[model samples]
Target: MHQLIASPHNGAFLVARPGARAGMRIPRALYEQVASIAESGAPLPPWLLEGARTAWDLDLAGLTMRDTVLVRPETGLGYGRATYEINKGCNFNCEHCYLAERRFEGLPWVGKARLLRLLRDAGVLWLQFTGGEPLIDRDFMDAYTFAHRSGMLIEILTNGSRLHRPEVIALLRELPPYKVTVSLYGATPDSFDSLTRRKGAFKLVERGLAAAREAGLPLELALIFTRHNAHEVDAMRAVADRYGAARTEYGTISPTYSGTPEPLAAQAPGFLDKTGVFQGCPAGHTFFHVDPHGLATMCKVGRENPVDLMAEGLDGLLRLPGIADAQMLRTGGCGGCQLSGTCRVCRPLAKAYQEAKAPLNTYCRHGNEEA
Candidate 1:
């Protein structure tokens, strides 16, 4: 059965099945209205009801048994959301970072404004501000204020190291984000600081989280997986609950975006799903990732090639030659891969062909097994 849910961060998303791996974002009010109508057992116009169901790829008329959802949010490209990495420079030196090459240097305010304008013009409703740490940007507030005034719902992904500062907290209080997602590396200062490699960084994260909560901002916590902190997984979740986070996101570490195995040594056991089969990646179609340098790609990982957003405008980049080739899923070498069912590898990662033309075996349960 299909159900509409408000993610812990309060975004409206629809799940086709009870435990579907992915959910489609939808307009919150519309989803609630549909659910309320369903609960009341009052029949609405058939076309209206069917429209929501067919919003994605699940055509109820054609695939009667396959569950589907239709997202009709107010914002998005032809689709409703976009992720912008505000800056690549980060305060922490985590051993598992994919963008280790990112220095604090990034696009200037004018460049950022241009990018934001492009997204707004594309009809995007949800704008996620991510970073090495977005708060560190000298002009973060300026960019943020612009996006907020542009009428886009804003989301934030941060390390929570700087939220304790009065100025940072004050800015958030003035223009609250739709949600503030903090990455939890460990539960205790020792465990956490070890991963971050900075003394007392954990305390800063704690203060940051507390400051956000005290400010009454929507908050969620995600546990970043690493072999160094595997023992503290449960305790980290407990910390998330203590903060009353709306949702808790956690996942295993994967190879670097460069397809290097250097970081694989930090991966925990049981990271990938063996039972799942390959499904098409949603990057470029339902989602896209843009970095601090104005380089756009399907996702953050395996970024061998990217559309230069500054050199070529959004329209020009989207229309560039070989655009389709860059986004296509590469599974020919996977031995009729079942890993796609639960695999984290996408078109770019697959194209990188790490681990001998298969997804990184460290993250893939079937990486070493024959099909």
Candidate 2:
């Protein structure tokens, strides 16, 4: 599937296929040329033929495409979905959480309301509410309601611990999110508590999931596989099935957002399977991440440089110094490596390697081959 993404190098837009190692930069003139022909049901001109393969694998000659979202352009940014981390303080501190020590000292409710208005006006259609746990955020309901009323589809990324709260359940019942994803730390109390390092959190999650289902909210379950809970994969899926969860996903642990390597040691056996190619990343392009305190950057993983939303207004935050220059990192040895073919390490993950300086054998399947 082709996705329209803003070029990080410049504010210009690029049409990129999912998982493409590189994106072809399309000039504005070229886009208009293709669009004009597409609308008129006329064949592409001869000059356009030479650029077709390099620009994108488009059948320019046939020119049957219509209603191109890329051509419509939103705020001249081309962003469809935006994820906001409302809060960073989580009740259950999972041992392998990426945002272990990350903190959020952000705007107050009034300022947040303004930011929501800005996002709505800027044409952000799908808004994702995420955090240490969005359910526990003090102004979550307000933000959720505001985003929904602003004509944005809302999705919540949260652990189910607070889902059982009366007000939280009521909010879900009143204005349901597009979907709610509950991260299941473990299936059993002992394993769950061990992973979160919190006593009696498993019960809260159980109650929260039940409450979500009771509220007629669409539910999804994601089980994070670590050395602590790899054995519970099947059991967790069964539990999700019983709850009638719409989807269940299993993901392996990655380096912490703090740039620490400690959590990498807790990976499950064979976690680093040779998945696929190590295409750069789509951080600032397709979707951008905003941490609490409005530190908007490429993504949460390799948050090396962030543009302060408060300092640099969203008017052109994406084109600011730190942001506009931010690209999928190809740092150090990765610039020209023989193992590039099988390397699944992306820019953010590569930053983790630079931080720890630990050999990739511990975390990468391709790196293991070299070892």
Model 2 segments more than 4 A misplaced? 1-74, 100-104, 320-326, 367-371
Clash statistics: count for each candidate = 11, 0
**Global lDDT for candidate 2?**
0.67
Model 1 residue 87 distance off true place after TM-score fit, in angstroms: 1.4
What range of 10 consecutive residues in model 1 has the weakest lDDT sum?
A: 1-10
Candidate 2 residue pairs in backbone clash: none
lDDT (CA) per prediction: 0.65, 0.67
Tens-place lDDT per residue, model 2, 245-277, is 966554555667656766776678765545566
By how many angstroms RMSD does model 1 differ from the true structure? 10.2
Lowest lDDT 10-residue stretch of candidate 2: 1-10
**Model 1 / residue 160 / CA error / Å:** 0.4
